[model samples]
Target: GAGVSQSPSNKVTEKGKDVELRCDPISGHTALYWYRQSLGQGLEFLIYFQGNSAPDKSGLPSDRFSAERTGGSVSTLTIQRTQQEDSAVYLCASSLVAAYTDTQYFGPGTRLTVL
Candidate 1:
């Protein structure tokens, strides 16, 4: 594909369960980002990866949430001990670089529902 792609466009999980979301950024793009959108709130930056190295993971809500980029390409977000508050739209974005330039191209997003 020419743009960012995400797996499991929608997910439904029970509280206390675990879920893993995947994202595949555009080829050659070294900068990738994860964002969460909850009701009434704008996109919340979850993490950012610059060439397989996450320089800023401070956006992650808690230790239960984690992400990793491999080979500077594919990335995965894992949420353990799922909570209802964790249910939201998970978005993935990518760009040439993520310093101060480059527009981020976002995927369709995966709507997670934690019941």
Candidate 2:
């Protein structure tokens, strides 16, 4: 795919269940970002991986959420204990450079539902 791609376009999970959302950034992109937004809320930054260095996880909402980028390309977001509040649209974006000024290409996002 030319653009960022996310798996399980929609997910329905029970409370306390774990969920793994996958994201494949554009080829050759050096930066990948993860974000989630609840209904009527703005996108909330979750994590980001730049190159082979450490990811900035400052934006994560809690310890239950974590993400990793393998081979500097594919990325996965893991939610340890799903909660109703965790329901949101998980979005992935990639940019050639990891900078605020770089244009980010975004995926359609994975819609999560918790019950």
Error of 1 at 80 (Å): 0.4
lDDT of 1 at 90: 98
Structural similarity to truth (TM-score) of each candidate: 0.97, 0.96
Regions of model 2 farther than 4 Å from truth: none
Q: For candidate 2, give the lDDT.
A: 0.92
Clashing residue pair totals per candidate (backbone < 3 A): 0, 0
* Model 2 lDDT tens row, 37-108: 899999999888897554588999999998888899999999998999999999999999898799999999
lDDT per residue, candidate 1, 3-91, as tens digits? 99999999999999999999999999999999999977899999999998999999999999999999999999999999999999999
Indicate the residue-level lDDT of 38 in model 2: 92
How much is the lDDT of residue 113 in candidate 2?
99
Q: Stretches of candidate 1 above 4 Å error?
A: none
Q: How many clashing residue pairs, candidate 2?
A: 0
- Per-residue error for 67 in candidate 1, Å, reads 0.2
